[model samples]
Target: MTQAEGGLRARKKRETRAALAEAALRLALEKGPDNVTVEEIAEAADVSVRTFFNYFPHKEHAILGRNPEHIERALDRMREAPAEESPLTTMRFIVHDVLRDLEGEGELSRRGELIMASPHLLYQLMLSSFEDERQLTEALAERMGEPATSVRPALIVSASGAACRVAMERHKADPDRPIRELVDEGFQLLAEGIDPGFRVVPTKGHP
Candidate 1:
């Protein structure tokens, strides 16, 4: 096939995938996600159930519309980060880059409401997040010239993940508040090291 043909096919697939996701979200909003089915979503998007499955493994995935591209870009950024940059700082920039486009209203607000209202969807998203964290952890470890199982890589990943979670929760609580601003605050707290005035005792096994 010609380059033009390949490009067109890729675009068409993206369009179909997006249509299915939009249909899934809209249906979930109108009739809870548990009530929506693959057939219904496909019909709404003018696609076949087989096509929907090709795009998403299940209905919940369709509703979540998790974009692979965003995570891929994030992983690339971490891998290419300068050697001198701290892992936390690298993560801050990566998060900002991934979420910057989502700063405004419209789809962002609708997704917040959808996920917050549905426990099932939230669980699915959580699972996806774990996978994303794992991939990012490996990339960060490679950049640090350390094993992925090392405590340092895991620590950075966990801490950065907490910051992202807090920012997300705050955004859900108030859609009017810019998500980027909240994310910045979370990263800033991480940068400062969450140290309370009082000293804390280390666990028996850990220093």
Candidate 2:
């Protein structure tokens, strides 16, 4: 195919994939996931069942649409990071970049809502998160010139992942508040040694 034609074809495929995912998420939200079917999702997206299958293995995957390509791209960025950058700075930049890229049209917030609404999706998200964490640790260790088994990379990944989780939870709780701001606050907390001082209030019945 000509370059122009190839570009058009790629755009079309992306649109189709997005349509299928949007349809699946919408239908799942309207009628519980258990009540939604692949055929219904295909019809909603105006694509054949075969086309849906070509993009995703099943309905739940379609609804979640957690793109493996996105993680690959993040790993690529990590691998190509500047030699002089510290591991923490590299991670902060990479995390913010991924968040901004994925937050298009508030899609991340919508996905957060869907995940919270469905137990199966939540479980899938947890699985995906673990995998992402594994890949990130490996890439980070390479960046740090250390082995994948190094405790330094693992600790950095665990701490940053915790920051991101808190940010996501805050976004889910108050979606109107910008997710980027929440994430920035999370990183700020980390920068401050995660020791923002506040005395704990004693419960009424227990001192």
lDDT of 2 at 24: 84
Record all residue pairs in model 1 with backbone atoms less than 3 Å apart, i.e. clashing.
none
State in Å the error of residue 110, model 2.
Answer: 2.1
Question: Each model's number of backbone clashes?
Answer: 0, 0
lDDT of 2 by residue, 59-101 (tens): 8888887666668887988898888877777778878877876
- On TM-score, the candidate that comes out on top is 1
lDDT of 1 by residue, 1-207 (tens): 999999999899877877888898899889988999999999999988988888899999989887787799999999889889889999988888766644431366677678878888889988998999999999988899898788888778878877876777898888777777887888888778777565778989999
TM-score, prediction 2: 0.83
How many clashing residue pairs, candidate 1? 0
Runs of candidate 1 with Cα error greater than 4 angstroms are 101-106, 196-207
Displacement of the residue 88 alpha carbon in candidate 1, Å: 1.9
